[model samples]
Target: MTAGEDISVRRKKLRYRAWHRGTKEMDLILGPYADAHTEALDEAGLDRLEALVNEEDPPLLKWVMGQEEPPENIDRGFLAEVIADHSARLAR
Candidate 1:
């Protein structure tokens, strides 16, 4: 497993407690989705995400969230997508 996946899973509970509101606390904190996220994400993808976050590019995040029509920062596995996905889940 990559460091990124590890971090995501570790932070999953704190970051997404509400996503699994009705579910058991332990289950939500240690759910299948967290496992898959860990396994599915590679080191490179994590790196890209880190880069996107470090750059502080709001447009990149905006594009990822599907909030805006489109932006120049559109790409495959940037941090924006990861964060926006998380944000969307949290907002729910």
Candidate 2:
């Protein structure tokens, strides 16, 4: 595949993983967000997002739900925007 095709495939894989994460709540939160943002992510951002989604659901859920802040290790700049988006959505 061409580089553009590769990125598209990667984004598709990420979207599938985001939506099939074994929990309805997480699927709902991440699926839409991934669909919205994955196309805009650069390689570095995609890597971070992939790593974030691979994390166990409990901690991931905590971060999105505002139950606990994401630890420094997992707190990438891209995630801050996603978290803020999630928070705003929740507030509405």
Residue pairs with backbone atoms closer than 3 Å in model 2 (clashes): none
lDDT digits (tens) for residues 1-88 of candidate 2: 8999999999999999999999888887888789888999999879988998898888888887778888888855766777776676
Residues 1-92 of candidate 1 have per-residue lDDT tens digits of 99666766645542353233343532332233344454454656544433433333344435544666444554444434455555556678
lDDT of 1: 0.45
Question: What's the lDDT for residue 1 in model 1?
Answer: 90
CA lDDT, every model vs. true structure = 0.45, 0.85
Instruction: Report the CA-based lDDT of candidate 2 relative to the real structure.
Output: 0.85
Model 2 stretches with alpha carbons more than 4 Å out: none
The C-alpha TM-scores of every prediction are 0.32, 0.85
